[model samples]
Target: MLNIPLWKRVVIVGLVALGLLFAMPNAFYSRVEGHNDAVAAIEGGAESPELTAMEGAWPGWLPSSLVNLGLDLRGGAHLLAEVHLEDVYASRIDALWPEVRDALRDQRATVGTIRQQNSAPGELRVRISNPEGIAAAVQAVQALAQPIVSLTGVGERDLAVRSEGADVVVTLSEAEQLATDQRTMQQTLEIIRRRVDEVGTREPTIQRQGNDRVLIQVPGIGSAEELKALIGTTAQLTFHPVVSQTRDGSQDPGGRNVIYPDLEDPELFYILERTPVVTGEELTDAQPSFDQNGLPAVNFRFNVSGARKFGDYTAENIGSPFAIVLDGEVISAPVIRDHIPGGSGIISGNFTVEESTQLAVLLRAGALPAELTFLEERTIGPELGQDSIDAGKIACIVAFAGVLVFMALSYGWFGILANIALILNVGMIFGLLSMIGATLTLPGIAGIVLTIGMAVDANVLIFERIREELKSAKGPARAIELGYERAQSAIVDANITTFLTAVILFVMGSGPVRGFAVTLGLGILTSVFTAIFVTRLMVVIWMERRRPKTIEV
Candidate 1:
């Protein structure tokens, strides 16, 4: 006889019930989404009347996880940017300058007085008083070249130190340049991800498009300009010793000093040392606060290593002004009124509360390694997404109705059983998606509709097999058992091939294609389960209860 075991029947019913229960939230997507967002805000210490209302809309014990909507379905910002690797190269080369100068000075007797010769960015040059000492100068500078970890530069020095006339020319080797580019790209992606996550956006796609380019697609954000503004700022904070303060733009600068305009008064400029005493990389925490005058400010704390350097710098430079530089511009040049022992300071400027909060967020998230030049930027509106969703709903409804009528007219009572399985198949897909937090795009919706039509394929094969067995003098129970046994191989083979195709699409495709693959792959799984177990169990129970002598397909 055609019978499912007691444990198998219980498992089949339990799984179906659990799937429908979890998928129930999606029936009211907006209400459930609001409830989830409100719960998150409350956990983050936010309070509002609207949030309470949203939180109460759903039961506290119910599942709130939703299938995240993709950028095409939720509508937000999209951007393509090119990372300026040359900026990183220049910074690395500039840092080597001090070491180069110190190394050459150690051989002062041979090289005489060493003068730094001005060169292009990413290149360092040192000129010696005596041309005959060039060999000793080159040897001293080459000693500072450190080996880098890279395929082409496994053991080779990163510096290409050579002598051009009387000056020792120092530039990054090709291998080091490649390694630096890779590091810069990785760091940029991580920092951008942190910045976006800090704002609490969902499922933002921050990925590297090529060697030098990044593609950002953040769903549920307002605009591409807003997103660019969030991550575009380098937020490079440094404290430099001031050389001089002047209003004249034409004021000459020393070869070792740099000139930057004050953040408050652009007419006033501060000439400062090129190297910083403390950098933002050491910052452990930053928060927005109010200064003594009740003006908006940012308070920052540094790590242990930074605290020692900052304390020493402040103790030694009492009564001297130090410039706080953000992205090369002097935000404030404050005089050290006293010896500040702790490495904690306040940055007070002409800032609104919003600006101070944003500054704190940027500081806490850390700085970008280099600048990003946007090559493409586009913002998609929610209206377009809603329209797409509406069209998809209509298409699914139509296909579902057509399939239901055709199956009912063709297969009679067994057709109704297949329809139930098809409904549960879709419900299980949503449940699995929500459980795993997968994203659903417009193409993903099409996959679900296609699955509805294909969900009955297994039932059709088994029903046809039963018709043939009944014609060969088999009773109802024998025909039913033989039908399922005969159709098992064909059903498994067909779905296995389709599932493999879905896996390949997911692995090889990007963005929307991947979303489609996810839904399609998940649908295949649920369809197979419902067809093989759910529909068969229903058939077996009906046969046991009714014990009909004959059946029609």
Candidate 2:
């Protein structure tokens, strides 16, 4: 211990200094946050006097990373939503209709004329005029079934077709329904994440709950309703051939026709074909722009397949009207003046610039395959978070004061060295948290306070061992060296077990439990380093300078 190397001492001092430097920004958290935001905005081509002032709030040379605060610490919106997975079943059945119809139409001589009949939810029935051709019609529809590629459904086909008298019945296989639910859940999660990220909310917590629910906690959003508005719209955009314009809902729309109202005028409605010529899924890009009339609009481009279909439809149906529908409301219906061969078009609507921008964002993020019914929603205020911070600060201060006084009273100058190391350990924790962009929460603060009490364990063990060696009439340097060597195993054994517990908690827990685990795990690493290297290095330096005949412990 007395013979510490020159390189080791330099490295120890350098690390401590670096940690304190990284942690300094937290002292002026708001200023550093402003500086970071200003810098990001300026880089993004935004310029203003306010931005310039914020840029100068903190020095550019200093480290600007700050520990992000979790929702419980910063306040935000929380929601628990149950996904309506059954909603996709009906749409899936409707989607299979075109393929089934085309297959049956190809064998028109045998099947005669086939017409879709009203059936139960998630089932499609087709009636063939020639009852003797029921077997042929079922075989034709069954040919459209595709193999499912999932692990649990590897050998199963997605559809099952059967004939009852002159009617051919079609429904999704059980395995296919299971696969669809899984896909819907995954797509919903991904789309919601993208939408939230586009808005740039800090440290949002979005996770699956049970099998059919999602839990969302977004910090910095005003309320749960605001967040719902941002992600709730399905954005299911489609282009359909308009059958007729009418305001009568009670009138029959006829076979395969649906009535939808205009987005701008609720009373004005358009009857349209149930199946769309093209859907938003085929879109590759969408951006907000002004149309030829200098009105707010969204310009969208489609993939190759969509482009071909759109071009063919427009070319064949020139002079007919096609409606652009979004989430069941007709946004616009313009007559095709010419063939739109490039698969790109502008959608003009009754919208403000902000609405157009949001629509573009949603289009780019894709649509939610199923609906979300909110089970719970809450808005946590900043004042409540401020109270949590204040309480945590008081608890930490009290813990630090008690630890500092106890150590100093027990070991004199060596105690003071331990206290300094303890302070640096805390700084290093925050430094590491900032480096990784960790979000600190209330439970995480408790972990830090608990760490403060645990950090002195190794020091106490080493100091007591030194006292024992001193009483045995050993030299000061020899006693210090033997104390650290003897207590090393005990310290290692104790911390290792605690570290394992932290690892297990991190893996098995969620939300607040995870926050606590992260802090505890990081604290263990920093505490062990400060205890073994930092305090030991300080003692060695002091001993080498003083070279005292006697030492007090």
Question: In TM-score terms, which candidate is top?
Answer: 2
Q: Compared with the true structure, what per-residue lDDT tens digits does model 1 show for residues 1-553?
A: 4667899899999999998888888888999999999999999999999999999999989998888888888999999999999988878887787898889889999989988766788888788998899999999988988899878678887999999889999999998999999889999999999999999998998888879999999999999999998999999999999999899867866666778998878899899887788899999999999999999999999999899999999889999999999997899988998887788999999999999999999999998999999999999999988898999899999999998998899999999999988888999999999988998999999989988888889899999999999999999999999999999899999999999999999998878888889999999999999988999999998998999999999
Error of 2 at 25 (Å): 1.3
In angstroms, how far off is 148's CA in candidate 1?
A: 2.5
TM-score of each: 0.94, 0.95
Q: After superposition, how far is residue 527 of candidate 2 from its true place, in Å?
A: 0.6
Clashes found in each candidate (C-alpha, N, C closer than 3 A)? 0, 0
- The 0-to-1 C-alpha lDDT of every candidate, in the order given, reads 0.90, 0.92
Inter-residue clash pairs, candidate 1? none
Q: Any idea what lDDT model 1 has?
A: 0.90
How far is 194's C-alpha from truth in model 2 (Å)? 1.4
- Kindly list the per-residue Cα lDDT of model 2 for residues 1-553, writing each as its tens digit: 5688899889999998988888889999999999998998899899999999999999999999999998988999999989998878888887788998999999899999999987887888899999999998998888899999788799999998899899999999999988988888888889999999988788888888888998889988999888998888888899999999998867778667778999999989999998899999999999999988888999999999999999999999999999999999999999999999999998899888999999999999998888889999999999988999999999999999999999999899999999999999999999988888999999999999999999999999999999999999999999999999999899999999999999999899888998999999999999999999999998998887888899998
Q: Kindly report which residue pairs in candidate 2 clash with one another.
A: none
Evaluate candidate 1 by giving its C-alpha RMSD to the native, one decimal.
2.1
